[model samples]
Target chain A: MEAGKRINVVTKILAANDRVADENRRRFAELGLKVVNLISSPGAGKTALLEATIGRIRKDRRVGVIVGDIATTKDAERIAKHDVPVVQITTESFGGSCHLEASTIRQALDEIPLKELDLLFVENVGNLVCPAEFDLGEQAKVSMLSVTEGEDKPLKYPLAFQVANLVILSKVDLVPHLRVDMEALRANVRQMNPKVRTLELSSQTGEGFDAWIEWLKKP
Target chain B: MHEASIAQNVIESVLRLIADGTVQGKVARVYLKVGKLTAVVPDNLQFMFGVLAEEGPLAGVKLEIEEVPIRVRCKACEEAFEMHEEIRLICPKCGSADTRFETGRELLIDAVEVD
Candidate 1:
């Protein structure tokens, strides 16, 4: 029988992923590495924000990154320019999986010297959907949304905004040229996630980068 | 895309329960109670489950998704109603946006109808 017709198939799958995720979490704790899963829509400025964050924070803390992309090692290469340890997971190798699974993340971490890093940032395959469902033993889940992506993103992709503890509104420099309604975006985000902290800044302009860096540095 | 990952999480949780002797069997059905706000799309998730469960111990298990619509209980008038559409947080009966949500933000395995 096809599993879709009569089965509680989604539940079984989530249950299974949670099992491995727990294991991944336990291992992450043992290493004392604060894992932060960065998620956003494609071109929502996740890579740019990370580049800026790493440039400033790398001096004070030991950092590493695992970049997830549908194809190409481009992101990994971009991050490597900052001189941090990085690995790229190309999902095309695995039959076009959109989100990185706990098992895949586990394998990726195995190749990294976890003991040498203070923080490990797994830049999820540029997606706002599936990435929120899986836990990679991260200390915090940060969602990056660029202003150019518009304010309606919070309502449209409520799942990511709700799960996020910190929401970084990136590409703020474009706000002058773009018609983004900042107040509406903020209000929408607050409506969905009452407690989520919001930061507005541009990675290109180095605006609000300090506050973001300081927040991440906190225990 | 994330549905596949979600499917993986469900499998792991069930196996853990089974390993601990809390549940026994070649699995039957897994029931999840997801809040309407959760990022999961049931249709996409259902599609991914079939692919993920192909060769695992849960090869033949069923995945049932029950989406709990956003229900808010107004603090002022003490009323509860379903939040069906758009991004309105105001209580329809009281017209107050000050209502507190009691549930529907959850992504949990409420029950496992196992065999």
Candidate 2:
């Protein structure tokens, strides 16, 4: 009986992206590589941290990097000086998607020497809200939160806080000057997701970076 | 705004429904279940839906968004509750900070209503 044109269907809005994320996961699994998605708001020190992280780990670990920006090879350029295989996926054609989708990563994966690296870091475009939504099939989604962004950031952008496996509070050296309440920031992050591990560091001063390097130590 | 892509996703889902041929006639509304945790703003989604869901069978389709509150549970005491504010995460009884999300952080088209 066509009494009413009623159709009941359940759909996942990210089904397409999730499918690509799954494929990327399988690809990374086959290559036996650990991929970490480095997400942050713009100017949160993602590139700087990567440059520092790669420098510290390159002696022992074969690391590769992929940089995604709305439009720029500047990050890729910065990582190249570290003598690693880095590719830049500029999303100018994709209407400047603020996040890195699995499909974007898939296209850039071909140029990366998957078999030659122990760890791969995908520095996603700097936006807390959008990048938190797209999963690039990384082993962990790590976000960098700087002190200047304020303590209420996690509460205001809870999705970024909730989804991140780990959150690194960057630019701690500026905390004294910026009046960033570290405890309040930690409380906000814990309230959003108590399970998220956090670390406070200053890349410029090289403070609290040993633990960062230690966390990435090959297991 | 990513709503442009999100609106496209809604249309794709609706198209798939029509392709399945289970429901008859035109699509009147697309019901979306947006968790409070997702960053998709309702207004943006609505505007994008209006713009992107304009071609073919999805033209002039309505989007009904149901926002779900963020729910969490204490890992230490198994306290299942929703927080009005994100700063207060302590278990009222146990006072433990060990808590995890039990819900929220979801964005899905739960069920679409067809005309």
Candidate 3:
């Protein structure tokens, strides 16, 4: 072997993941199912929001969930109470991947009744940064930030906000008690992603959830 | 962090190249291009790569990373420029909020040096 031989192999690092994601997207489209990838930091009310969403939309829309967590089937158990088919992807067994990759979701899809569900929510493992990097073939990527997390989160974690199709300011019911500035938070999110739609809602209070439900119903 | 997973992917990619005879010799270095918008921390990626490469054909391989700056095109004024100080999507020229990223989310293995 000769020294200093250079091979120009320009290739996307996540090509395999992206290819799987594209296939997932096609599969979802063919099934006429709307898939939403929910990303957030820990304790951002993703499961609670899903529980609320399922309660409201279940009457008209058949919903299924794929919950990704570092460990535990706790979230799946919670969603199962809502009587919807839910699958849990525990990353701990698979080297504790911080985020859910497309391949993981593809495997999870095998357990889901895709033909019966109108909407599928993939509750990504609660981490803002890593989840944004991996595309999961969702029609929308919704990122949640709680009021307690601080107003500067969007600026600090710009990539998560930049890629989000919708930014949900969760736990808005606690805003009055906290020192966090809602205006500043909104402005920071806007700075990172100008075109992203934002909604301030508290899953606990159900305040501002009507808009969220409406957004979910959009064609 | 996801850098570990990314490092594994990088090693796998190179190994695949070698298996297919795309990469002929033992790899000395892997050159990666990561954009500013990517979540990867270059230092972390390098560390992870070194650790994960210790057992494979990529053992003792040098990981070279080139950071790519964020560039955006203003939809309003059609001016394309690089974002320097901060990653605000607003256009610098037109001051318009309607702008699309041109080159910032890149995560690619550009080339490999073999011996």
Off by over 4 Å in 3: A1-3, B78-85
> Residue A170 error for model 2, in Å?
1.0
* Candidate 2 Cα errors over 4 Å, as ranges: A1-3, B21-24, B75-79, B85-88
2 against 3, candidate with superior DockQ: 3
Worst 10 residues of 3 chain B by lDDT: B84-93
What digit string (tens of lDDT, one per residue) describes model 3 on residues B11-112?
888888888888897788899999988868999999999998897778899999999988988889998888776777777677899988899889999999
Model 2, B6-103: lDDT tens per residue?
77777876777667775567677778988777767899999978977666678787888988887777788887887655535566668787876666
Instruction: Give one digit per residue, the lDDT tens place, for model 1 in A129-173.
Output: 768766776778899898888788888877687778899898888
User: What local lDDT score does residue B93 receive in model 1, on the 0 to 100 scale?
Assistant: 80
Per-prediction DockQ: 0.27, 0.56, 0.76
* RMSD value for candidate 2: 2.3
What iRMS does model 1 reach? Answer: 6.4
Model 1 Cα lDDT, one tens digit per residue, B1-115: 5566566566777777778766665577778877776657888777777778788888877767888887777787998877667644556687765666677766776666654
Please give the lDDT score for candidate 2: 0.83
Q: Write candidate 3's Cα lDDT for A112-205 as tens digits.
A: 8889999999999999889999998999999999999998999878889998999999999998899998898898899889879999998888
* Number of backbone collisions per candidate: 26, 1, 0
TM-scores of chain A in all candidate models: 0.93, 0.96, 0.98
Model 3: lDDT of residue A126: 95
DockQ of 3: 0.76
| Residue A79 in model 2: lDDT | 94
